[model samples]
Target: MFSFRNFNIADWFSLYRIMAVPLLVAFIWFGERQLFTWFLLISYSTDAIDGYLARKLKITSARGSQLDSIGDQITLVMGLIGLWFFENEFVLANYQLILLAFLPYVLQMIIAFRKYGKATAFHTYLAKSSAVLQGVFILWLLFFGPVYWLFYFMVIVGVLETIEEITLIFMYKEWVEDVKGIYWALKDKRRLKKKSVKNPTS
Candidate 1:
């Protein structure tokens, strides 16, 4: 997955987040909240840049999607760690809410791994929205503090995205990437053809 020979410009951009992880951890270790937040912002920016570049350049591929998803997951985990370290009181105060929002995501991961032997990189529109809200909410908390409305919206969108992902898992039967959402899934010829192939008698 980390093969440099096959990586393109956008893949390298996606890889930036994973490569930044150790530096981010070091920033936290030295108690450099400002530096950590700044670098974290840069990391998040790469997420948008990579995706746009991939589509614009027509360099999208299964490998690229998987790599991007890996980078996103790493960045999110590190962001939450940074939040817990810098905003311990806030995290503790909202621990239950955070856990509630995270539980379904955990379940989705488990389901994906069991079905596909890896994580889903569906990149649905809802997933994109959820990622944006999560990054915004975390950055807001880190830079200033939590806004109740933002946090609530983030949690709601996140849970909905996870539910959609779980639903897609069952719908696909086999692992697929870049599904937009259920509406698009219903019209997905790839999925429909797979079903037809499996039950030809029907």
Candidate 2:
């Protein structure tokens, strides 16, 4: 599923994030804060670019979705670790609030993995919003400092996005991608039952 030989340009972008992990960690180990933040920003930017290119070029696929989701998680985890390393004071102060958002995100991943043997790639609108806010918050904190309002907002959206993800996980028996939200899921034929051929019931 992750074969580089068959990967499209968008998939290659996702692969780039995965490939950059060691370099990113090396920056941290070397105490290169400026370099790490700039590189992290580039990682986040690749996320947006890959997603856009996938949609625009119609190269979206199950493999691509899975790769993209993995890349996003890896990048986000790296961002948070960068936050902890460079901004230890802020993390120490807000560990409770951060977990309030993070724990449920972990739970959602657990639910998806248990059911599908992998993480979801719903890529819902709420998920996109949360990702953007999270990327912005992490970058802003690393570049300047934490903003209280943004932190609170990111937490709220993160929790809400988790709830929506859990619901969607239940709604679809099979792994799926690019779900917009619960509303669309309700009308999704994928979630509906097959009609009786003879009865033809609605």
Candidate 3:
């Protein structure tokens, strides 16, 4: 649910990212490299801002997490689109590796929706690190150009993060929020509770 009339300041930031997608897309379509990079940077920064504000103000909720994840996915796709447009030759050169890292990501989304009726929001540390590297790699490519070292590192982290997310999906029956990663999941009472529910005699 949107909490229509009750959105807090942190929620507003998340909403901004969602609402700004059209603008980001427009920049890409118009071939406005600098404009796209600047606005995308702002959009990416809001991801961090919203999360910090939610925690600091104690305003976190399931709705906020969902909104935040949707915003993140959209903004990231927009960034990748921008990368493809601005750095065509570079992307063309490494398209194989890109697809290799990207396929697992798509699979993870499919599995999450099928299993829990929604995408995940585990927000694991590995996931966060991947996001940071992705943002840096894309923005750096747009602002400067492709840095091979960073590109390889981003791909490795991206694949690892995708694998971690997919693993977590199997670890929890229902959707979860803010699960640090698989290690934290091992100690998660929510997972244990759900398991206990399934095997009552155990």
Candidate 4:
């Protein structure tokens, strides 16, 4: 169902964000402080640009939407990991007891991807807020150092996101049906394209 590669600015912006994932990974893995910070800013800029382009140009597509979700996850995950690498004690040292707290996230991601065939529910405000919260938390951690109170703040935000996704699964069971419909539509388009190629005048 991914279909947003038609020179749309929104698509370009989304791709820009996705492309930064590698640099983020490298920065974290290699511990490049300056490069890491620059990429982080670029990543955030990409986020803002994509959203702005989507709204201003009305170029939102299924592929663009999916890319947005993936971009959010990758950016947050990599950013947090990078922050962890740079500021280890603040992250783990402060919240040692809540280490297993992320187990739920792992399970949730599994269910969201495997069972639901969705990286995330696209239309949820909570999902967006969760991403923003994580981004803010990472920036704050980097600039302000470890603030233990942020752990509780993140816990609350994360819990809301968890509940939102879970509730959305149940509330919108037809999401799978919608995906099936999209698949069928794409299949029809391909068949039409094949027929056109085979028969010059149909």
Candidate 5:
């Protein structure tokens, strides 16, 4: 029911990425606890497949890019939220700790969107590795339940991943370009807003 009606072959992977949403939701919401574990694995698998197929088929479109970003956010962010809730329900950790780790990543997403007009392209190897590590850490925490030591381990890993991203962003010089683009766009936007305020008709 979900597949786009036009393609016989290329659409299969796109369909998979779309399908992962409800599957993930169902797993987290109503499925057996053990089954929810599969959700993470499947969602990530589809992430890989969709990316590969999009590049291999040369069918990358703006819509596809947006869809992929939304899908990823839904899975990763929502899953983390779910884990945070689970932690609360079980008295696993202070809910505040989850917020502390989560907020930075949320800010990163917002900054990337504002600056680059897209989520960091998935093409960077270290970025992908960082994502995978983050996902694994979250899943492990979910499955094993939280431990104080595990929390420390995750913090260390998370810091390392952040460092990797910072290094990679600078290594490519795309960071400067991203910042410059956003700076110019915002400056122009603000100037236009000011002019509009001064002259109502023009």
Candidate 6:
């Protein structure tokens, strides 16, 4: 997956996020919150750009989807680590709320890996909204501080997205890429055809 020879433009953009991790960590190590936040913002921007380019250019593939998800996961973890390190007081005060929002996400990951042996790249509408809110909230908190309303909204959307992901996992027996959501999953010809193939008599 890390093979440079196999990477496309979108993949390279996705790769940028992973590559930025060490630099982000260094910013934290040096207590450079401003630099870290700006770099983090750029990393998040690449998330949107890579997906847009992949869809616009019609170069979407399973490998690309998986790679994108991996990059996103790494970036998110780094963002959270930065948040914890730089905003230790806020994190400690709200650790319960944070864990409340994170537990289900961890469960969703476990379920996906158990069932599909890989991470999902559903990229559902709710998931996108959640990701956007998360980035916004994280950046806002870093730049300013935690705004209760934004934090609440981000947590809500994140929980909803995780629930949707878990539901999608139960819906699809096989690993699929770029699923929009449960509604689309129900009407998905690929999934339906696979089901029929497995249960021809049904």
Please give, for residues 1-202, the per-residue lDDT of candidate 1 as tens digits. 4689989999999989999999999999999999999999999999999999999999999888998999898989999999989999999999999998888898999999999999999999999999999999999889998999999999999999999999999888788889999999999986757867887985
1-202 per-residue lDDT for model 5 (tens digits): 2336644333455456556666666765674456766666677667777778877888765455555655666677756756655555743545566555566666666666665665654334434555566677667767886556666556555555454444433333222222222234346454335546766786
| Least well predicted 10-residue stretch by lDDT in candidate 2 | 190-199
TM-score, cand. 2:
0.94
Backbone clash pairs for candidate 1 read none
lDDT of 5: 0.56
> Roughly what TM-score does model 4 have, to 2 decimal places?
0.75
TM-score of 3: 0.95
Clash totals for all candidate models: 0, 0, 0, 0, 0, 0
Candidate ranking (lDDT, best to worst): 1, 2, 6, 3, 4, 5
Model 4: CA > 4 A from native:
1-4, 95-101, 176-202
What is the C-alpha lDDT profile of model 2 across 1-202, one tens digit per residue?
5567899999989989988899999999998999999999999999999999999999999899989999999999999999889999999999999999999999999999999999999999999999999999999999999899999999999999999999999877778888999999888774444322323753
Candidate 3 structure quality by residue, lDDT tens digits, 1-202:
5766988888889889889989988988898999999999999999999999999999998888888888888888888888788889988999999999888999999999999888899889998899889999999889988899999999999999999999989888788799898899999985658967997997
lDDT: the better of candidates 2 and 3: 2
TM-score of each: 0.96, 0.94, 0.95, 0.75, 0.58, 0.94
Sorted on TM-score, best first, the list reads 1, 3, 6, 2, 4, 5
Error of 6 at 53 (Å): 1.0
**lDDT per model, in order?**
0.93, 0.91, 0.89, 0.65, 0.56, 0.90
